[model samples]
Target: MPENPTTEPTPGLENLLHETRSFPPDPRFAEQANAQAGLYDEAKADRLAFWERQARELVSWRTPFTETLDWSGAPVARWFADGTLNAAYNAVDRHVEAGHGDRVALHFEGEPGDTRTVTYADLQREVSRAANALAALGVTTGDRVVIYLPMLVESVVAMLACARLGAAHSVVFGGFSADALRSRIADAGATLVITADGGYRRGAPSALKPAVDEALEPRNGAEPTTVAHVLVVRRTGQDVAWTEGRDVWWHEALEAADVQHDPVWVEAEHPLFILYTSGTTGKPKGILHTTGGYLTQTAYTHRNVFDLKAETDVYWCTADIGWVTGHSYVVYGPLLNGATQVIYEGTPDSPHQGRWWEIVEKYKVSILYTAPTAIRTFMKWGEEIPDRFDLSSLRVLGSVGESINPEAWMWYRRVIGGGTAPIVDTWWQTETGAIMVSPLPGVTAAKPGSAQVPLPGIAAEVVDDEAHPVPDGGGGYLVLSEPWPSMLRGIWGDLERFKDTYWSRFPGIYFAGDGAKKDEDGDIWLLGRVDDVMNVSGHRLSTTEIESALVSHEYVAEAAVVGAADDTTGQAVVAFVILIGEFADRAADDAGADAVQTALRNHVARQIGAIAKPRKILVVPELPKTRSGKIMRRLLRDVAENRAVGDATTLADSSVMTLIASGLAKPSTSSED
Candidate 1:
């Protein structure tokens, strides 16, 4: 936690890539910005006082907190320990009470071209009714509920209803397998499940109830699950095997219940929700987030980071309800700020490739936030697709999920924002609960592909393996030197594991699993996860940098880099790239594919030094990605090392691995010398 640990140089990650392009905030944008340059100085003067001010100004606390933070428990921090609040009330009811009931809370756009608009009053009534229905089914304070539904309006209602009753809700992605769902259900000891019969995907009705039924079914020699009821939403109206005693229709339950329910006021440290993140071990880690502090930070960051004008701006974050970005930006953050937002239900390319732009144009979305993977996919589709649509309403753009390459960032700024909007590339994990490192959009001069710096109240630094802070223009591990409000309380049911995983790495500092580098200006640049760093000829190179180098090429649209075992170099870099739509035909033949791969290899060598060049480059049609749009580099490594593909059930399309593996058999460009 020392501001300056030892300054001794160490052999850590090699920062070989440099980005010099910078874009400052527009004068007009900065004039009306919510976060001014003075905010940083205020936070630096008194960090705790700054947070206490934010907590008071942003959130609607039932009982004001006296104590700001209690870090006496070491790794486990108690923020705003004496405060009391209700997340659902702050999100829904308070806006209704403030005469904003007529304001649009959600602009729901179904993938099948169906649409519905819900106001704050409408949301309050629905959430209250859902809470009543849940209470009738024996769900109350301290109870756990598992939600396994698609991106439906009811999904948001379900999460809010759980929060309203002080019951923790754990949402599992609808794309997850039955085994994955069952593991989360068992770990949370959930008593009820909320799901739809099915949801629309790619113009087809995909059954979801079957997965829920399979997950809840009796296992051989396993203990019975705690689930007492199954609440089903009729999204697709797909036929499902009925369990007469345990199942209840969503609409019927809400219709039968009263539309009036009281919000449960819980203490600051009360458990709000438990979201599961993938762990090194087979089991998923249930990240426990408490009530008051989590709401405080999420609301604060959401308002300032995007320079939100809640009354005028129509915000949209293209993340599903299952991910943490959705938990923060899509649900809690925007609603807490009384901002109207859009929520889509299907893939970006269902009926056509222009589906997302069409929605944005229809909604006049001003603030847009999405992942880099999505931007790269749009790049592969070409810029002409978005050029057909009117995106003049977009003002501020944002990126999340992972580190973005500079080319994708520039494309997004040019094509989507019309080269005028500032992009806020954010860095945070599921455990962090909200955005930690991000540009203020209006105050800071934005740097392409860099998170830039920690937010006003956060303390983050790049440190070497010896816990010494790396000097400016050095690369090392990213660590949080101080506790933040929204930091995860602990791994659910396993305090020791939480201590061992995050705390033990630096004794007291929370070591983020990702590696990072500091520029000459001391700005932080994320270098993906430490496990993805490749060791070639004793140089520890970042996969993100190599992938960025490949993507910087004009022909390349997207790239994924992995480290495969090499007898001579210990680990060699292998890259998979997708060409732009116009150039796809150039790589259609074996000879043409080899030519394109060779060009990309040379491009990387020139972008960084020759030591950072990819050992092998394969022109792939697509890379394996998860439902949340993160590339599965582990599976890519499996294909690169010539090993049998591992469990690919978690991928958005399991067949993607098969295609990538088969592509590996074709002629590839490689070098051994």
Candidate 2:
């Protein structure tokens, strides 16, 4: 018989995971939201019309848009082009005006057990006063203001106030260095800088005023700064150095100003915020999200994806306001829908490891959204800790930041949700302002690691290098084929870089910079970043998939994989892993550590094939991560290749990589040795 050429394996194609495990939504929730399943069909009929309807229905517009989208210029898309809307009014005022003024908007819990519940009415007054104060500080429409603060109500107020006054605000993460904050302020050409005296962290009052002062200092004997004023909030009552005329206290300023500023409507395309994201090279790219479209999608997604019941559900998204998740889910999304949410201002393990669970129990939080790294950390701490608390309030769980491993997903569902709550593993980025691809908790029978599909009105696909669609059970690049309302307008002041970074990859299609796979049922499973996809010889393998495979092992709790320089293959897989429970004790002894490393390598070989097995594995107490719980794989790659790590300053614990490097110096007993 002649050979069947079509059935043969391709030379350069890599082996892919055929993950078939699935979890259906809770029957009660599904029954309650039968109409949500119909949105897919409605959006399929006409995506533009669906978005137009969503925009009109979700937000209160001062001037309605005639056109839904104008994409003639390709990459530069304008959604709700002719619309005019006040983002702050849509987020706060409308809820209060509709007789929900007494509703609790933010249930703020401070690190020192201090609590404050701000209602819609209270929020409206605070925002109005803030807007008046900002205007008094010489801020006006289109002016840039930099907000660098902790997870306080003041941060939310400052953001909304900027929106109310039609000023574009840039929020720098409180954990960031002065250099990082300064670079963003310079990039945005911000005139006003808002910061707190300090914030509480790990049961200690950390001073932030010093960083702010240093950031404003003259560099290389240059001119002082472009900043006109520095507004300070007294959070911890910590004394700070006064800049005389340039500095003003929040209380004094707001007290002196009139609290009757009206919200101003801005054009739909007018920039709402300039959020800077770290790029692989050069300065961080300031992602620009505009008004009407961004707000509409954020509000709509928050309502549907979480199945938020504004009056009942106590929602919480564990993200800092410095990030996009905080902007959309934590603030704009929930407030726009009149939803009550818990906002905490401390690390999850501060004072107690059960802090998050305590808050969930205390607030009766029905919807819990958080990052997968935090989940893995919770898993590492053991289920017994959470077992001590009453987490029965949790009805729906969410995972973001990175593609969640199946093991972590199962742990999150079983341990946290008690196996009943649905998990909505979302896939989006800073570039896409809101959740782009996520399972509707009430509609999807979600697979453990897969995002399942794009939401209604979002067009996404897994395509090969030639821009052709990849077959099911194949791996390819993930791209958004259609522009959505919440898509970023451009990289602020660097339209060319934005075009080159996102659009130039696939011409018209928005290359998401992530590798992905389509399952046999055509559900999309996100692989990590395209840069994270390593080439072994000529075959491509996803670092996230391998890391998932590693974490699926009984002993491993969390894993980070990096592609290191290799002579035999183009790049070799190197892994740094943290063990928990019994594995941690076993890894303490030299011989047991050797045996465990061998077992993990074999485990990965069995689970994902030998090609995906790590060439080297280091059993470490911790992995390098940022304050936001993102693993610093770039530093790991540097360590793996035996090169000097560029910067360790951004790490939550700068000593972590040093510890890992020291651990790697020990002998290897594996067959790969």
Candidate 3:
């Protein structure tokens, strides 16, 4: 007998969980995915068979042989038994052979008003030139190269060039400071660094080559392996310090190098790239991935999840290639499926809040994948902005980063997606190579904020500290029990850290670092980072809980809370809020401030518990954020804790941080702290 025998069942949830969002894939979409998954599953299910199947998926040689995963060598595991396949040929040749050479491969929109549409033929020529130029610089197969440049057509050119030479490319975010760039360059032992003169940011052209020069400067008086030649593309006309022997222009080199070169054939599990990810602790871990299996999974998932029509639809992912969202959507996944995508070089709010809407209207983008933080920002800008433009072409919308709050999710569903398009509230990490769990648009029942369920081959569960499954209606650490395609091979240069950080949390299980609750209806609700959970007066409190409570108030526009030091209790909650226009009246006067603060505190007390009330509330103008719209909570915490700030390099504007710091120094009169 179930404990809920007396209560009614949560209706429609079962339909919500297992239904395929791809109700009717483009006939061939499901057929291709099903066939691919069948081959992929068979290949991986039995280690030996998996490699054989992966080879079969590729244009393989007449030779195939013994050996599976070579983990015994550590950090140097080889796959594909003893077989060979070319990455560039697979990404280019096979599609061309299938009569897609004339199809538009890249519909590129540059920062300026100019546009360039690169067909498969044009892309092939450019890639051949870049590969030969790289060879001239002594970049051979197995060499690591660091790419730190703006979002331009050249970014794709560089990636393909590296693939052609069988070199591992680590693309550091262009916005990252020299220190961040230095860390990745050193970690990968990259001998070559490719940069650009500069690229656009929020509609303005800025110099990036200078940062590359500074980043490559000899460090700590030690001989540098990376003080090598810096290949710069002249994107912006900014004056640059040109070095004769070490700095070479992209145009000059590409002009001289022969435009005919063959891609190197390597084993499947050979290292592809190392993308560094910083967790809550600020320690960056380099995540590694490979060739054959990665492309296979990305291609299969992209086809099924979006039911992509490569020829008809114009797809655009608003994320920069610096982040994992960009890696999967912008670089690997979409391209592997050979879809037409718009690559914007500016922010959603650049020039004005209407920028994103205008792009979608002009390009008629069929699908848009973005972060939840971006949705909330658009919500902050008001719906009238998006309502001004046409968005009917959109069939699918994607959400990444932290789980979206309910109200914002609804706004995204209605306004940006025009209510009819399905939202894939995707859940994956920098560590996970691609979208691990998300709703397939055709088969999945649309949920406002929920990610829905795991992809067909993924196995996820909610487990407690002891690795036991939690009861229904309970929250626990999100974990994966089985290896899925596109899972990180390991943290670069540190397999032990990989085992200790993720695998060790729950032996033989991959810990997601996020806290999740399986509701009574068996639907998983991601609760942000497990570390986001706080202990206030012996009662467990989620920061999202308080933030959500505060946002629920009509006067509140946005809210962020951080636990601070408290002698009486373990920690005290401090909240920073940006008020809506209606709330402006309250922010202007002492009386209004007191009323709004008290009301918000009372609301949280009622919603959660008395102990969960924020001890201090600081009303502010705006939260410091990245270009992509994620709040810089680390900086906000620095303000709350009254500590010297850390790494203000990536903040949208350091002044916003200065504003926050000054405001936080003086406490609000309504505060209990």
Candidate 4:
């Protein structure tokens, strides 16, 4: 690779950060990997043919697809349109029929020390029973069901059961408020709701049924909900007020239903599921994904990207089933690949700080996938906690959800991966349905904090405002040049909004709504969301870049940067950071806090440039993050701009904002620029 280039500022975005470190694939792992260099060449030779081959090989289609793609619909593509398949059958029943019935499918671990081991055959029976039960409740094909349950094996069963009946399932995160749940239920026009009495969190039972009851109640003379029945799982055995005829016990219904129901075969274009995008303020856009294409891509990515050896490897993705990551990776992808995975139902720190590593050690997990926020939290808790466990079973590490900082990437590689395991930092969205851009662990040399090149059969590029491709060492908006098999069909019931939001930005291309830059090596590095980009004195700076620089400092553990309103500069950089465990005590006093803040500001200036340095730095004990482990920078912007903190109900811990706001009331460590 050429040396990092020094160029003038570009029109789209100013390229600032430079990374030279790269780790090539280990020869031994590469030799036996599922994906090889030829994979890319094969895709390049004929993209549609490559995807067709993948569909034919990875998925078990009830009726084979003769057609690969039909772009006659433009933005809303029809992939494998004429094919027929059952997602639940492909994920569960097919594996059982192939004599893998005894293979473990799920290893469920509850926060309160409860455990359940389920096999492929067991999953098939459970799904069949649930499908029968749902059918008895008048949930037929094309009906929508809302699932608001904790991360339990039952949650997985519910989703697969819905798929088995050809009914679309929309899983709302358990952490969401009643209003959020009601909005989604109303939008989807769901007929049935599946929830739990409560689930254990932080070593205690957290009631979930109340939220469901609240959501079902008509508020402000609103029309009665379309919901006909509520299926409640007795997780915590808590007393829940029930509407006698409307609410039914999950176990009782399943026990009465026969376990011989057949899977419903539907066209490839049948809606598989609808997942609403998180962190949205008003009405949420429901991203609709179809069966054949979604299953094909997710299965292919799961097998190759993680170098998954289904028979030998134990994979675990630490995501709740409510989010897209949980839907795609935790439930669909891994299960479709016939891979055994661990599913945990609690926060990382419940019971103890070492709960996650303990589960990893117990399960002998070979592949671990998680978000950078969790990794940074583990960093704050100190490495000694993880060091206490035996992590040698871990072979590959994966990062998702958002752009990871280079420092967090390094820490994850060194401490968690045991220095040699490959890390695949995947980049994709709910709209994409599956992984799009990610380094093939066995083919490309890994670069810290960079997603690298697009995956085989995926066409992505960094382009300027004119939709022209940026140079190798330039920064611009990221766009997908061609439609992929797993691309979302459209936002449910809102075709025009879908076109305006994603397609209107770049004609004939899918704008990812993210800013990105290419290194001199032509590797792509995500620069956070374009909405988070700051304009400082006419220079556009990525909050991700500045946060990366801050985390690069030895004393800083995690950081969130926001652009505050400025009279002269238009926008000024303001940062809130959490210190490492050892350095956390230093921020107790004003002098130490000032010294630490100044040092981070100076480090950012040296790392990127003076223009990227933060104007003010606040040493926060914790950053507000959502349940999915994404930092809530909008809340920080409120604090930075001296406005009242916005609605923090969605945060994992609303008290975090209060602590940060109180800390800001004290003396701030402003840079003397």
Any runs in candidate 1 off by more than 4 Å, and if so which?
Answer: 1-20, 663-670
Query: In model 3, where do residues sit more than 4 Å from their true spots?
Result: 1-83, 279-283, 606-611, 664-673
Best candidate, lDDT? 4
* Candidate 4 residue runs with Cα over 4 Å from true position: 1-20, 279-281, 664-672
lDDT of 2 by residue, 1-673 (tens): 0022122222212333344357776678888762378899999999999999999999999999999999998798999889899999998999888999999999999999999999999999999999999898899999999999999999999999999999999999998999998888888999999999999999999988888899999898655578999999999999899989999999898888776778988999998999999988999999999998999999999998888889889999999999999999998999999999999999999889999999998999999999999999998889999999898988888988999888889899999999888999999999999998889977889888889799989999988777888777666788999999999999999889989999897889999988787777788888788778887766677788788888888899889999988999888888888887787788777898888888998888877777777888887788899988899899988888888876988888998878777654333467653
Please tell me which model should have the higher lDDT, number 1 or number 2.
1
Candidate 1 vs candidate 4: the lDDT winner is 4
Question: Taking the tens digit of each residue's C-alpha lDDT, what string does model 1 give over 1-673?
Answer: 1123223221222233335478988889899999999999999999999999999998888899999999898789998888899999999999999999999999999988889999999999999999999999999999999999999899999999999999999999999989999999999999999999999999999999999999999989987999999999999978999999899999999999999999999998999999999875668999999998899999999999998998999999999989999999999999999999999999999899999999889999999999999999998887889999999999999999999888889999999999999999999999999999999977999888899999999999988878788888777789999999999999999999889889998888999988887877889988888888666766767788888778878888888889888898788888888888766688788887778777777777767767766788877778899988999888888888999998889898998888878754354656544
For every model shown, what is its TM-score relative to the native structure? 0.97, 0.96, 0.88, 0.97
Residue pair clashes in candidate 2: none
The lDDT per prediction is: 0.89, 0.87, 0.73, 0.89
Question: What TM-score does candidate 4 get on C-alpha atoms?
Answer: 0.97
Q: Per-residue lDDT for 519 in model 4?
A: 75
Over the stretch 341-367, how does candidate 4's per-residue lDDT look in tens digits?
Answer: 999999999889999999999999999
Instruction: Report the Cα lDDT for candidate 2.
Output: 0.87
Candidate 4 positional error at 416, Å: 1.1
Ranking by lDDT: 4, 1, 2, 3
TM-score of 1: 0.97
- Model 3, 1-673: lDDT tens per residue? 1122113222222232332232223343334332333433553467445534444653334245354445554333445436566567666656666888887777776656567788777777888899999999999999898988777778888988898889988998888888888878888889889998888876788888888877777767755755467889888788899888999999999999997888887777767788888766746898998876566567666766776888888888888878878777887777776777888776666777888888888888988888877777777778999999999989777888877766666678778877667677888888778777777765555555567567766678877767777777666678887665567888888889888888776667788887666666555767667666555555555676577667767887778888776787777788888888877666677777877888888877766657778888888888888765778777877877789878777877878888877753235566452
